[model samples]
Target chain A: MEVIALKKLKVFLAIASSALILGGCGLGNLSSRPSSNNGTQLTGHANNSNYQSVIKHGHYLTSKSRGVDVQQDANQLNLKSFENGLLDLSKKEFPTNKYIFQEGQHISTKTTEHWLDRKSQNSQGLNPSGKETKVPLYLQQMDEQDFLTQHGKHLKLSGMTVGLGINSIYYYKKKKYGPTYKKSISNATVKAEGHKIGAKVLARLRRKPGLKHIPIVIGLYRQGSDDSLVGGNFFAYSVNKGSSIDGWKPIDERNYVFPSNSGDKGKHANDANDFSNFKSRVQNFFPNLSGVTAQAHYINGSLSGMHVNITTQFYSQTEIIAFTQYLQTAAKKYLPSGMPIDITVKSTEGVQSFLARKSGSKSFSAHVFNSY
Target chain B: MEVIALKKLKVFLAIASSALILGGCGLGNLSSRPSSNNGTQLTGHANNSNYQSVIKHGHYLTSKSRGVDVQQDANQLNLKSFENGLLDLSKKEFPTNKYIFQEGQHISTKTTEHWLDRKSQNSQGLNPSGKETKVPLYLQQMDEQDFLTQHGKHLKLSGMTVGLGINSIYYYKKKKYGPTYKKSISNATVKAEGHKIGAKVLARLRRKPGLKHIPIVIGLYRQGSDDSLVGGNFFAYSVNKGSSIDGWKPIDERNYVFPSNSGDKGKHANDANDFSNFKSRVQNFFPNLSGVTAQAHYINGSLSGMHVNITTQFYSQTEIIAFTQYLQTAAKKYLPSGMPIDITVKSTEGVQSFLARKSGSKSFSAHVFNSY
Candidate 1:
């Protein structure tokens, strides 16, 4: 069952986000099913020929226990329908999660924007500057397979996962923008949240029982900015009839996030400036000031908040206020949008804190920092 | 605290193998330690700032019970020495397994040749003919960490793992050969063997416990052939003093073979050909001829033996003998050497089996397949 092994590799690679696209290597195709040299589907592989090593490795449950047909061809035949059924079932189970097919789904502008927001939140670090592309990602059916071995006496185990492709989102984003759209968030958070959502999906899918003894697995996958499946996370569910949905045991889930698309632009282009860069940028405003330091807090990838400390030889309260105002304006000029910036101005007498950020409108807001 | 999250991510990324090298990414460097702005290492991190999220995620144990210095810098200071100690300890324990260091160790030419032989066996498909760089990877102390929470009143658990960078092997093969090499062994088998050795190492480490309640974990890692580390298998160990080493519980181990390397040259070259490809290659040699199929058995990464089934349309005994001889030569041509290749030329009349492999010296031997 090299195919089974490939299936496992595919799953693992998909989950590990950083796995190179297994294509282009002379090692044959890994993403799709293993094909014969002549390009024909291996429809009639001998029993366990494709899975013997995997079985020996104890990664898959055998069909020997029951009269189940775990043949690849047979499974492939039902894979689509089963996945669709699972997707529909998932939608029915957790509609708030916004599950949908990568194709054949129409969403509202609000829904798209919400996904964009989540996507932005998921991203971290600096992104290329361009037009903002607002792409919506939704849940869609993905690959499935039987388990390495049977469950209990009458139970058979099979599982499938889902993916969130950004192809359509990219299309939407590109269409909304001119050539490209600045992805608001960093690439790192998208991966972290993708894995979380995947596990969450798996936990949710555990409750749905279309087949007896076959435990279901659910996960989240996202296409890289390149439209390749670069990020995914998955979990397997063990069934318990008497227990609640939460009682289902989740198998090992990958914690790593896959890389996003290469060409994908982000909304926050200046995200490259972290604590260090911000410190220097702030220093540029006060060239002669010797003691100036900045600490930026990155929640996902973007700066959520920052603390800038500056020491001056001497300054009165009014002078400090004026300097703080000028600094607020200057800080706003360089910092990424929506981030809270706190400035600590220190004198020989005392230290004062100024909090600066965007107000409800386009105006900037600055005030004295309070303990609360 | 978020730095701790970054630390966990770094550890997980490093451990997962296939996890993208978080280098150059805006997500912050994860593998070593987190340095502050101006490239100065952040020394005075707040309590729980490094381990809070990891503890919340239940990934590591806090050193609350015993006075264990679980801080990254302290741990790092001991990392190289600790790893060296473990490697020496492992070598002393499992002499037959032949563990060597990537550097700073002298071994005999025989040992180097033995490793080269094993390395050749581990490699399959088309190995470009060239000078072989025989590097014997010895036991070296590797990444270690404190365990996930304390086990009991006195037991403070800690563990370590080793990685064999197959990047060199992949490079040697790619330079000597073309794009592909026959990967005779299954990823599953490689994974199984890796865990077995990992457990063996753990068992050996358990014998030298300086502390009664301190449990040690051991495992192996290989960067994927694509150097993406997408294919990584790992196992965790839980120690009990009274029980036999085998009795020790092994946490779940991944059953995926880390790819050799990919086009990233030594780092990203796709290494996908395994036992399945060998089987397929053998199968392809007899595609049009019905009843002509072969089964190749691999141990670790070498071909141990093969079972070839041949059905005759019309052939004499002499013809059968020639076909068997040709098949053996072809098998030898593709499969890793020093292993036996068995061919069973069958017909409706009777079955004739032939086994071919290298003999004591330059001679090759052939015999009828027998039970003995």
Candidate 2:
């Protein structure tokens, strides 16, 4: 009886040990089991052991690993291997390095620019100056799609300005100045009117959709030997986004100190030597305008910042009627809901109010509906 | 004299020992030293003794000094340290793996039928039963791009023989197959009048300076009804660099097999049951066309591949000429230099001859050129 009991006990113990081992192996129906950091048992052919090992190794490196070892591994992997491993690791970890990869770094701008310059220099094996020719075939190939695909997302069109110029003038004499003096004065006024015309032409671009986004810059320079401001020339372009604009902030004392003329010896210049104070002031009136700064210098005459000023003048009676009708038609076409057109004339003196009514005929004239 | 000599010998030995010890320290002169697996050493900052010791201890699980125990240090460093160390070692041994990271893995299909089925099912929010109202949008997009970009690179037409019904026969006998049919048949006959059309077309494509290098592929499909052949359709496209006839071989087979329906009952029948004979003939003529395989079947018709056969024969000759001309003109305009046009044609007696001429003048027929 004693021998039988001992044999039974041994058998029971053996079975219990076997069960424990199986449980540890995760094959037994037990709740508690050791988790493997690198290896685990799974059922079926779908459980790819090699793939699991790779995943486990990757996890081990990223979470429990240090940067020093990672750097070492990065060094160890060949270009292809490192790229593959990084890609695999990234999938299980970050999944995408787009956030980490610097934008615009993949495109080598210097190389592209250099190639463009070389092509330009060759001028399709034509003359050195590349003048009086059709656009380069290579450039023609660079349609909107090519530009957009290559640089659209990375491009930031900031701080750009346009330049204005005039070659001739028109003028009217004022009765306040005497008749004998009026002749010489009228001549000067005519020349200045030409420059004003140029300025007005440039100003009209503000209404054009494509040009509206670009800041208009004005610079006054002599074209031949004209004393009138109307005969001056101007130039323009956008400022690079990387530069600081704190100096060009609109403030009382520094209002006239536009940041232009980048390549000029004068202060606040643009690289192209085209930016000026007049351009900056006109650009400022545009509500949507941003990133405009300029520099200015007197070419053939002296004009202090105070003397160089702009005054908003009111429309004449004839002009008022034409503009009112134009506005009404435009409003009707663009604004179906309706809009308000306030015709107020502002001058250096003060403000005047009048009601502008459209004449029914094609040739319309404006009469003062009311006066104030 | 003996004492002086002993002193000199001792000094020399001391200097040699010091040099060996300094070299073993791993902190060589920074300015002239080469970069290690870790990184480049900065000038005047070569005293990286601590870093070197840590790296060595991490790698070997032992200390550099004779008496120091490093097992505890190794344990404290953990998996991160091991990973970093391993990475460093790898970098020293394998540098190429650093840049080429894997983006991701994808399950790709060699044939379009599975893609179409899966796509259709997905679009309808249910598993497809082999019959769908229309091809999926994504499939359409792919097909559009393939048609445009891979024109001459793969077969793009289907062929079949049509039996005229009694009513249709009477209509054709009276009105010459109606106005559209009359115009189309005349155009086809005119285009196919000379055998040199193919060669001239090839030469014209070669003459295109911009398309000198592009590889052209022409796909041919036969029209048949009850195993009786009719007219054929030919289309062309170009391939991008590095992709060759090898890449499109399967597509050609798929094109013929999927577009016809004759052998639907044999034990070897598959989705491509209809055009088995056509495919075999295609393979025979253009052995390299083995890769141009596709699987097609008719869902509603009593006979497989029957609809395509009737459609091909129903179209008039003028329509075929117009279609071929459109494809050739597109190729002439867009492809690069040196591209060959792959031509596929189907006829009642197989592709005996086909004619094509440049639009406007019958004098310049493609059949007159024979460099092929």
Candidate 3:
């Protein structure tokens, strides 16, 4: 029995030695690996204790494209929203409580940059050729965040989520510090192209050895233009469990800006009417208000959320308190219930008060900035 | 008021005409003049406005009494003055940079609680009797911050500062979850009672085993209620030398919520014209602004220091750099320059850049949090 045990130990040591030798000559796959990273497989990466602890910074892992993506990202708001919103979607599928977040080690930054390039002789670009004036650039940036589950002492990759930041308007200069030219892409074209790219990308990603069996979520975002105040929203998404994506799920999202300006309130008539009535009530209470505007969000043609921005002429704390209390009453009386609504009243100086309600909650809580 | 403004305008015009001839070659220093400070002593317990390197947390400390005093110091904010404001009263007698900050060792949490309770049987309470409804439970919370100066082998208490959190309005319910009944205290009575309490607390603290001669500062604060959007300010403070109370010095600290809505022509001829003018100039120069607001600190009605928070609409580093530069010029042009003026520009995600001028400095210094 002792001799057999010694033999078994010897055999195990031999296997480990051979594996180490192969790993030592890791340069064999170096060319295929990502920059700044050792090309560590998602399953083979170091265990991250962050997921088990309180998630303060966020659950999303730092990708190889983190820095470059921000630099190439279209605008400030979209740049932030792209990764954050993607994390929000991924968390819904793979919660932080159950899974650990890891950067997508499978795809190299060079590979993503290649896919983001124009389809030239040497580049396998995801964007259109220079001849296609209408769609100057569709794919702005690609981000990947992997979710892993702890299995004993090792971390096993549970799933991966991909974010595609597609551009609405591509602004480019013919030369450095030269006149700028822009070409806009329609939302329909962006959606169609995004779906096509998702399937192709899924097929390509599945070809990678470690990713064949895991689930993948691909969120397609309509990135904001340079002049857009707010970031764009995810227009569609696709989730595939085993190797291939079967079909895409189009997200029915719409934002009704300043509903009072819309002549035909459309299917969002109730939301538009409610928002308009709330604005009027506020205006009636405080005629000194500079303006009261709102953007109501709809999902599947149903009101999901609304954000009201109130620019006020009053600066006193008493006035702010009175108005906030009055606004809360007005919101409850005029605005639709059962949806999250946020309102911020501001003087030219800055935000004076903030009022909001949680989804399905009856009452709205308000805070007025203590003014002196 | 019109006559005063006319006379002031005549004086301002006279200064402006002469300033153009001499100031063109004489640095073009054109911000508003401070109101009453004819350059006071730093050692004198006046307001200091130098702590604006870090931003984002509101100007006041979020208390933790289940959202009350020092209890809820759950996170961060470095905005509070050290060798300035009410602290300067203590700090002038005890230089802070020479000592190390540590939690107070002498006072236990239970002891402070006893002192906060109403004077009653089985309790050594410091508050006035519950029978006096007019001044009932005026002392709400107490905070202790200690500084230790390193001695040869051990640390010795260099100084101690006690914050008296007095209630402006006493809100209570007869039973748990019952309707709250509020008993408001007049400022005059609060001041009288707070001064009386300060002497007793100082005498009690001085009797502690090791706190004999070390300077102790007692700051009487008028705390805001649960309904107040902003936290209360320290109104008066007394700096003691050796176990005794000196005369209380009033803190004429006023925080103007950036600019008032005194828009160009004031309804009541608002005196916040300088700030409004500055805001308008910055807004007009850079149309891409989310909003800009400030909390300008004044001591004895003089602009001692100003903290301006600029929220940008764009996300580009180049635009931020340009805006910061433009803002620096605007700050020098529109704001009072003699004070420690600070400004932080932020996107919704986080801070992007900050610009500041140390008190008595002629030029501004700036830094960007991220290059991209």
Encode model 3's per-residue lDDT on A1-372: one tens digit a residue: 000111001111112211111112121131221121111121111122113210111111235554345235546667655665576678778876677566556778788778887786235777767654344777877778777665543456679899888877777777777877887879888888888777778888898877888999999988777765456778888889765676788777655566555667576776677677767645644546888877666778887777778898755333454466556655765778888887878776566667778766887765543322
DockQ scores for all the models shown? 0.01, 0.00, 0.03
Query: How is the predicted docking of candidate 1 categorized under the CAPRI scheme?
Result: incorrect
Q: Taking the tens digit of each residue's C-alpha lDDT, what string does model 3 give over B1-372? A: 000111011111112211111111112222223221111100101022211010001111111211123232211111122112334444555564465434344677668767776786326688766554344677766756566554442335678888786677776667777786888888898789889999999999888877888888898877655543234567888888866688898876655555655454432124356777777756644545778777666667676766777887665443454466555545765676687777778776455666778778976665443310
Best by TM-score: 3
The CAPRI-style docking tier of model 2 reads incorrect
Candidate 2 chain A minimal-lDDT segment of 10 residues: A140-149
Q: How many steric clashes between backbone atoms does each model show?
A: 64, 103, 5
Off by over 4 Å in 2: A1-372, B1-174, B177-197, B223-372
TM-score for chain B of each model, two decimals? 0.26, 0.18, 0.67
- List clashing residue pairs in candidate 3: B63-B68, B64-B68, B64-B69, B64-B72, B65-B68
**C-alpha lDDT values of all predictions:** 0.31, 0.21, 0.58
TM accuracy, model 1: 0.21
Winner on TM-score (2 vs 3): 3
Poorest 10 consecutive residues of model 3 chain A by lDDT?
A1-10
lDDT for residue B154 in candidate 2, whole number 0-100: 19
* lDDT of candidate 2 over A1-372, digit per residue (tens): 000111001111112211111112312332222233222121111111111100111011111111111011111112111122222222332212111111111113332233223244653211113422222111100000000010221212111222111112212223535331111223343335334433443444344443344333222211211222211222111221222111121111111223332443433233213234323323322222233322122322321111111223422221222223322222222211211212222233222122122222222121121110
In candidate 3, stretches whose alpha carbon ends up further than 4 angstroms from where it belongs are A1-61, A67-75, A95-97, A102-111, A131-135, A173-181, A207-209, A224-226, A369-372, B1-372
